[model samples]
Target: MLQNTVSTRRNIGGTEFPILAAALPVVANDPVGDTYWHIRLKAATTHLSSRPGQFFQLRCPRSEAGDPFLRRPMSVYAVDTNVGEIAFLYKVTGIGTTGLSTLVPGDTLDVLGPLGVGFDINPEWDHVLVVARGVGLATMGPLARALHHNGVALTAICSYRTPEATIGLEPFELHGSVHTVYDTDGTSDIASVDSLIREEHARRSFSFAYTCGSKRIVSLLQDLSSQLGFGGEVALEQRMACGLGMCHSCVIDLRRGDTVESVRVCTRGPVFSLGDIVAPEETLSWYRSCDESAI
Candidate 1:
């Protein structure tokens, strides 16, 4: 399978990591809580050199759900270079993820990526903040580890529909403090979350921020980034085909400073500056009525 790998270079923070398009062996695939599956794959060190916010186009195996024509774009959940492994935490939502759910140890999973841009981390920042919910937890997971590795402090505000459905606990706990909010308790409400972020920002004085999962949260953070004078990034949720930009299927209108331009989510980003996004509250997509991710 390693012999089938294809490679290309992508520059992030001035370093180039070869993009991997290979059929890697699944090392572990297991259910998480009630709704998600955590799958690990054995791959070369190069395959695991992915940064947070970057994603892969997963070729789900044929199953009862049938053969899915397009590969699913999944954000990298975790990477372990020491063990030559990479992992993804995905919900079983459609044919693609349903097939993914059937994978087991030693099975080959065709994957194309470490694709797209990743979160831009500023080395000078001493402390940072992250806000995530549901699949957003998977998107933010690797970034937390990278920040921890760099000795940067983190404060995570995690939201979930239920405690049982929550994901990405360990990385949130590493090198930082975590605040859990659940929809059942009503603490995950936008207003309450806005208040929580403001208080935390005042105390920790986070120099930068990052968020994934909810538009309301992104909207809230966008307001704060302006009011508080701290800059941040948001990892957008978009359903894409071609993971590469060739198809232009994931293109979206983006506001950058004073100019508004269309950009490709798979290329320009699944990640963007907090202030650069336009009307996140009105961003009516999972890239529309979407969020079950895995489909």
Candidate 2:
């Protein structure tokens, strides 16, 4: 049976707690290419109970004169209960992320979180596949850790624009098998990723598949899951001005039976079952036009 690590009635997605956190030392901050950063922050006791796949809205300290007015939504990379700390892995995408990279130890940040519904891992599944690209790997770390602790076998594939862009592979390797893929340099490609998923599915017959990345990749995995006769879940990446449900900006169209309805990604999920979602063609086009290096 799946251990109930979180309470269903706790309103994990609805409740938002504002917290003032102090920056801890960086775990790994590589400023080459796309600039991968892994930052840690001291958290309150309540925040320490964060589950995998949940995220936080972080307001970076103001710059000298002008700064971003809105907080950035970041995935909960990992939570260290022992130290009362939470971590986030992010790429320097815009002003918000660039500001986050500049923080030194003891810097304070306004954070609101442990929000959104997280991945629901079935305990019955003996083995599962986790597919992620770019910074999406950050969201999967905590889920992988939970699965490892539960003795569930994991096969993870992390893809990046280049080898230098990859971050936080050690934790996944420690928990289960890992496969890395990159673009342009020919280290790996979409075909290789598909091949790995096929091979793993054929060999172990994955109990489920979990993925977070570009809409293109998520769509591919969703199709693969259907073809392989296994259920899958996807964590979406969307622009959010508000981490709460009040902002309809993050709404996604979901398919329910024969009809489609809109749902808030922030409140309902950053994570959703593949079967429950309907990705618009425009989203796929946007993903194709985007620079692979851009997070």
Candidate 3:
């Protein structure tokens, strides 16, 4: 399949391109809330080796609003290879996303994608657990489906600030077990996530845990996995300008050994082994505090 594939011509920053072409229905409005939009991009390339927790970079429809020239990064929600389409779940938090929200069907939006390392799925892992919050739900959707198709057991706990913040979970239910945890207040706390994992662990020996959205939550899962003796993986989120690895905007401090090391979230991972990452406690606590401060 790689033989027929063409290297992504749109070089946003030396990244892999899952974005084949901009789909005609350029913008799709999902009332996930006044804040979020679900978009579909036409991917002409045949091989989308994208796993869960990988992300894409998107350029909003061009306009006179004088928005940032840089593309904004987003997570890959799902990929339909037979149809040659890749989907995105994004929230309109700033000028870039606001411009994206105004686009209608047939409008053109430049996108580059399927970039970054993704979650690892092992055939030996009979049971899989997914933990995510808000828009983070988009990052893990495809993995759940892939695992289901492979006959691996799946369970998910997706959290949102309120009922309106939830979408795209129905697809998860169709494939495997799904449980929603709607936070009335937008806390995105580790306590709730910890509770969910504990509840699930009591029932069965989950082989692996997949997480996305908040770094704090990822760190928490990593800690919980260690305590429970289950392996874990995390999809990280960081503010990015170039979706590719060229820019160092998304560098993260990782533990390589006794020393803390830097890893780029764009290329090295949107996904990382929970065990391999270093400084989980301090780094994630800072990140979660910032997230709460933003709200």
Number of the predicted model whose lDDT against the real structure is largest: 1
Ten contiguous residues with the weakest lDDT in model 2: 1-10
What's the best-to-worst order under TM-score?
1, 2, 3
For 138-253, candidate 2 gives per-residue lDDT tens digits of 89999999999888899998887777677878779999999888886654566677787898888888888888846666667778988988888888776788877777878777
Model 3 misplacement above 4 A? 1-29, 46-49, 63-65, 185-189, 280-289, 292-295
Clashing pairs in 1: 285-288
Give a tens-digit lDDT track for model 1, residues 120-144: 8877799999999887899999999
lDDT of each: 0.83, 0.75, 0.70
State how far residue 9 of model 1 sits from its true place (Å). Answer: 4.4
Give lDDT tens digits, candidate 3, residues 1-295: 1122214533223544443323334535554666767877555453255556767667776555557688888777888887777778888777788778777766666665556777778877888898777777777788888888888898888777777767769657988788777667533456766777788888877899888646566667778888988888887787887867777888777777677777778877778888766653535423434464211
Q: Which ten residues in a row have the lowest lDDT in candidate 3?
A: 1-10
lDDT of 2 at 39: 77
What TM-score does candidate 2 reach?
Answer: 0.85
Which residue segments of model 1 deviate by more than 4 Å? 5-16, 280-295
Error of 1 at 140 (Å): 0.8
